[model samples]
Target: MYTQTEIIKDTTINGSEGELVINVGPQHPATHGVLHLVITLNGETIKKIEPHLGYIHRSIEKMCESLTYRQFIYVTSRMDYLSSHINNEACALCVEKGLQIEVPARAKVIRVLMGELTRIASHELWLGAMAMDLGAFTPFFYTFREREMINEIMEDTCGARLTMNYMVAGGVAMDLHPDFQRKVKLFVTQFKKRVPEFDDLITNNIIFQNRMKGVGVLSGEDAISYGCTGPVARGSGVSSDIRKLYPYDGYDAVAFDEVLETAGDSYARYLVRLREMHQSIRIIEQLIDAIPEGDFQAKTKAVLKLPKGEFYTRVETARGELGVYIVSEGGTTPYRIKFRSPGFSNLSALHHMAKGSKIGDLMATMGTLDLVIPDIDR
Candidate 1:
């Protein structure tokens, strides 16, 4: 229950000879966004981690109040750009719930396909960035080589690589490209081969294991207490995958394991994402050939209106669960909008995890959390 000022007062280390105060970023390259971490250090051991955020805040929730439901979905893309497709999907699902729109079967399969691809793309980038954060740079190049193939697929199908506004209220903005299936199969084949190489290059390296394996451990109870989700919760043995729990966008039809690890350390989180990529590939393999030949989008009015009520929907994003809540007064725009984004909740555990660890260990902890700061600030 500490106020912002009180929290800062407690974390600030005055210029004492044995202690130091350092800013990790509002612009440090290792950080994913404009996240500013004020680290209080007694030599190398971390006394505290106080994050100063909001550098990229756009008041997206309030902005959603002004924009129509269909238009608001794209704004979420700018929040967690790596998981943009999933973000948009959450908002669209919420809007569709309010409208009681029954999405076409073809649209459902296509949405799931895009969701899995987005998950893999996000994890590939996370693996690269996480390795780089631990001082191994070569994996970044190798990981991005595979990630770029997914981006090519996204560009060909969605007309944009990042922040793709593909999801609509009833279904998708457009149908899948004719080449989508062929390219995804090719990428999955190559990616499956490259994953073992990642294990060889970084995952099994003694130095990498030492940096990750017992550092910044978060237990299952603490993970749930902190409302952690996605790999962060799964790493700690908390079963919190929304796709598995809620089964939206034909997720129930596809078979894939909810990747989990009980070690609850940086390496466990790393392993969760790695295995989740394989699961995503398995999901695509199941549905890519079976996409129903039907309308890609459901019939909807040009200017949509929602009945007076509250609607909420949750979806599994690359980072975690993204919940979109909307309040409507029988209008084209939402009366109030709120997004329960995973990054903000996950960031709350940073101080808890990073304290008593080395400054170097902080990188492993934060990297495993896989934070995207705009999601927090928004």
Candidate 2:
């Protein structure tokens, strides 16, 4: 058997029927993280793509079993760092469900607003990175210009940009910053005008369109079969938006369409995320000015303990649906914890989508899936 180092260094491994096996990542820039793929190819055509995970696994679930309920929630922020706010919300919601905590309306609205902002910020980064994967570098800078605004807002309110750790078991850690509304409104106004430029720069570009449009087509049935959620499923016209189907944290009160595209290709996924960013802006506009006055955090004991039971909560992260499961034994810390992260499920479909496709097209296919490596490895 070939050693791991040799496998990675060798460009090709001899396979049956003269097929060639190659490794795509673990350090490839296109992956956006430490993701490894063993691909079998016949010349430029891909025959199979096998994802080799665990390069960055931290055994987060096992670690959570040791930390108290209050502390474990923050660990999830590292899983999907791009959707850190939403990941924390999912864990907090699960804890609240077990404790029967009724979060204050003001806190609920704040949580939802933060979640939407996180969604937009995550999508902005994905768009830029996706463009860069396809050999366009200019859009990356353009997208970051708007994303930096959201980062500043997050930093000002939550004291951190990427992994905010702001959401808690009862509610958010604190109230919004005094200038939260004005800054959010400013972001909304500027984003609305600038979003169209995204289309002009990359979305409508003939070369980019050709690279993405029909590549990596996945049918709606296939998407569901692979347990894909978020844009990956919605791009195939799957109605899997957890916010719409199972609203939480004042999501029910907000008015926004569940963006969908039926084409089920790379372009369709691209359009789904692009449109969803607009919907996130809409959710923010509805809640930013309407935040009610009340305590930002609910009352809870300092030493929190959950009743013996199993609890689960699901949230729509920027990548897809993130489900948190906890098994409590009437203790301060969890007996067990498991995360049904979307990246792992979505990544499972890569082989199905990229089979028989050219190696050059793999970047577009994988880029649209938007797999966050830690999210999968965790």
Candidate 3:
């Protein structure tokens, strides 16, 4: 619900400003998902923007309250399946905290590696989608060509491309594939070689530059108050990557730069994600050979139960911070669960960013938002 402020109504003597309420969509391709924005416009200037959500909310929190600790990990995979490893990590961390289980050193290293891979994959898909939203078609295919390698590696180990229930409470569900190291090395080599081509193809392209260069400017103050995270926050000159602030798994040992941009505009967001991918590759190469041999799954009783308490975990998803809040009642299931999704906070900035832009710029502006509706709705 919007704030309860009295309206300064101006019904009579309206200017030559043609005002009308326009519905952007529950189906607009540029919305990034089933997001419907009701905007009041006077000519090309936006007067007001209201977002109507819940088109995709399946009450995932309620469902988690019925599933056991071991079962809830798979449910979180649906929130941001592009970064399923991170989603699983959050669930596992919460359960681990509750159970006080000591995961082996091997599990932590593998989790960090997979988490970094998920981050790269999520950013890759976002890059393609954002480019396509701006009417650039060729770069999407180019980005996907590189991203397909990550999906193949995931499929071989987890048995599914997306929404893999790969992480358990104390350790991973399965051991790393026999060729995991070799395949990741190949992807690292391929990604490093292809990144420069992407810059030449889209990032440095004149048409894309014209569309994104100075549009949708969000100031650093606005970004902080809006609770933005990931590249969205980093683009606005904010350092809020959870991996850096709160290191989990093997993040503390790895050496990588946190990508930052001070422009606070659509182009800034694009540049931030593009550079972050490079850092992800750097971390992957550092840890590829360091994956130690040990038990993948920690020993736990058949029917797992968590202590009665509140468990909270904040993980940096591809888009931003995905916070999972779970309340247990000394049973197999949770009493209540709340997910603070990144897209919701990031999309809220859309109204402020697109205030005076042209209709075409609206697509360019929203593309930078990089929303996945299920994450928002869930």
- Candidate 3's C-alpha runs over 4 A off are 1-17
- Candidate 1 lDDT by residue in tens digits, 118-151: 9999999999999999898999999999999999
TM-score of each: 0.96, 0.97, 0.94
Q: Report the Cα RMSD per candidate.
A: 2.7, 2.0, 3.5
Worst lDDT 10-window in candidate 1: 1-10
Give the per-residue Cα lDDT of candidate 2 at 188: 97
Of the two candidates 2 and 3, the one with more favorable lDDT, higher being better, is 2
Cα lDDT of all candidates, in order? 0.90, 0.93, 0.85
- The lDDT of model 1 is 0.90
User: Which 10 consecutive positions of candidate 2 have the poorest summed lDDT?
Assistant: 7-16
lDDT winner among the candidates?
A: 2
Candidate 3 TM-score to native: 0.94
Scored against the true structure, residue 277 in model 3 reaches a CA lDDT of 88
What global local distance difference test value does model 2 have? 0.93
Scanning candidate 3 in windows of ten residues, the lowest lDDT window is: 2-11
